[model samples]
Target: MTEVGNRHPHGTPCWVSLLARGVEATQEFYGRLFGWEFHPGPSSLGTYVRASLNGKNVAGIGELPRDRPLPIAWTTYFAADDADKTAELVRGCGGTVGVGPLDADDAGRLAIALDPLGAVFGIWQAVHHRGIETSGEPGSPVWNELVTRETSMVATFYSLVFGFETQHVVSTDFDYLTLQLDGRPVGGIHGVGRGLPRDRGAHWMAYFEVADTDAAARQVVQLGGSVLRAPRDSAYGRVATVTDPEGAVFTVIRTEPLPA
Candidate 1:
């Protein structure tokens, strides 16, 4: 969460959205999985809905452009005070701005871009909407991470673009950097080198909090989705990677221990 009423600071992971092949079908899948309620969003971006959990906005789902035919994937958006300025920074830093720094009515200004490594992400300048209303709670986003080939190089790109300070999380052999804004951890970057998914390239991954990781993974399969990775414990929590019916990948994690 970006403190509800308060605007998120620049460089923080402010929102995550999925542009799927079918809007209603995507809504049905996510609603059943995360118990999210859908509400109409800015129509300027085509069929779009904001997903809310218990009345607080958590994410967005929009219909993919028929003409462009983009991949069915979730994109993590970072907060920007000025969307156009951010787009300039992206281009100056060797990234590509594939979409607009244009207004989506009164909601906000946005631009979709790709990092130098071709990792897709977004920049959001909020107006009426303040990004996610709740986070770190069940059914809400808990973390966002960039998985790419080299953390050092891409870390510098984000640092220059977002003024992010990178904090190394692991040894040189295992490359990981926790992105910080104002000395607080906002997101992370992981370098997997040759292990990068050839089809996906570099991309930001969104993690949603769930009450039970194993149960959630099973529920995903039950709801016509697939578990890409089985539930497993990690340093942060028990997590599993899963994809929606349309193959948009995301992770669900049990951030707290279950009752005995």
Candidate 2:
């Protein structure tokens, strides 16, 4: 397990959040799936709670905004030194800021935005809350990736906006690039070409760590959620795609255990 301290470097995938339709039900679904515990969060964003694992914050869940009515999905947040400046950079880089660089009740400054290819992501200038506190272990976030049709274009967008350094992943058939900060990979972009989902479009995907991929996928179904993709072994781990009861999609992976 990895424990995160306050102040992540800019461009890191620092936090993730799910805005679902039902607050209590969403909490129960995730809590049961990942063994998470919930605690209250800033009220300015409506009913929200921080999900914790063994006393460390791992993610957040908020009730869907009544006025906005967006599709239930997980949003990956990148850390920023200055949210206002980052929002301007997003606008300057052919992206659109759909939400705020405004304060989230002193927890942080946040903004939701779309990339040139319409992939949704978030920027956070943390205050008292310093994003996720633990990761790289079962029940915590392990990766965040963007699936898009224009990998090169979106890579340039994020590189310019977030100061992320891009390295093309060498593959025969896959168009993939890893976004790096200080030579460490923070996230990735996968070029799906015309294979992008029509209804979903381009979006960020968050993957959580699990102890067992097949068991987690089964539990997702048992908890009223569904598995979009069956568990499969990959170079990184055994992984499965799943959705919550309210249709929020995420992946679960059981990577080879960390070395002692």
Candidate 3:
């Protein structure tokens, strides 16, 4: 297990990609939610924006082409020393790499990989961009959690590749294992088993910390994002499930109070 304060064996978590049908609407919605500042990314990737709040990159937003059958969603990215190596590790462990070990100019090299149960994630090799520099604080991303049916395999795969330690202990009644690196909880993994809707397949879901759950949910609806679940009290905090304007699903939880 990586002891407390150990540097991330792979690299820091960087760039998060979000899919939005209404790019302009999402830009405004999250702008209100996180107080994020945005700027255009490379001109070739139209409608993709790099998001920062308080001068730190926290997430990203872009338009999803309607031609594709893909669902609207937020896919998180983690930096790797070698994108190719990370892709190999994913395949060796029974996951599928849907996209490339391809380069994105001076920005980085990247590939999209899905776990055996089909939760997609991005492997990033940073060139110009590193990652969200500040986290676990109010108004920034406090945590990311992946939920799936193959809990132990998902845990083992990441542990072997990234050196993340799986804490047998959980944070809330719903949490499975605390995903730790250098001894602090960076994210978590949860087992869906028979708990979720019967037709819902195993997938990765992320949680963004918010100041108020009710307000955020309302903004989601206002911005064209659908509400899958209403705000409710959980053992950990008040949480709600929502889909972005593009149909990418995620959750938000109110942990600490927002600035008044």
TM-score against truth, every candidate: 0.95, 0.96, 0.84
* TM-score: model 3 vs. ground truth: 0.84
Candidate 2: TM-score?
0.96
Model 3 worst lDDT window (10 residues): 1-10
Compose the digit string of candidate 1's lDDT tens values, residues 210-244. Answer: 99899999999998999889999998889999999
User: How many angstroms is residue 257 displaced in model 2 relative to the true structure, after the best TM-score fit?
Assistant: 5.2
CA shift of 127, model 2, Å? 0.9
lDDT of 1: 0.92
User: 1 or 3: which has the higher lDDT?
Assistant: 1
Highest lDDT against the true fold, candidate? 1
Report the C-alpha lDDT of model 2 over 99-126, residue by residue, as the tens digit: 9988888788899999998888999988
For residues 1-260, what per-residue lDDT tens digits would candidate 3 score against the true structure?
11213222463455578877788878887787667889876554567888887787778777777887666777877778788998998898888999899866566677888877777888887766666666755456666777776478788887776678888764455448877778877677788677754544666676777878999899888877789999999867899998766567788888754458
**All-Cα superposition RMSD per candidate:** 3.0, 3.1, 5.1
Sorted by lDDT (best first), the order is: 1, 2, 3
Q: What stretches of model 3 exceed 4 Å from their correct place?
A: 1-12, 43-46, 136-138, 170-175, 197-200, 256-260
The global C-alpha lDDT for each of the candidates, from Candidate 1 onward, is: 0.92, 0.91, 0.74
Candidate 2: the clashing residue pairs are none
Q: Model 2: how large is the Cα RMSD against the reference? A: 3.1
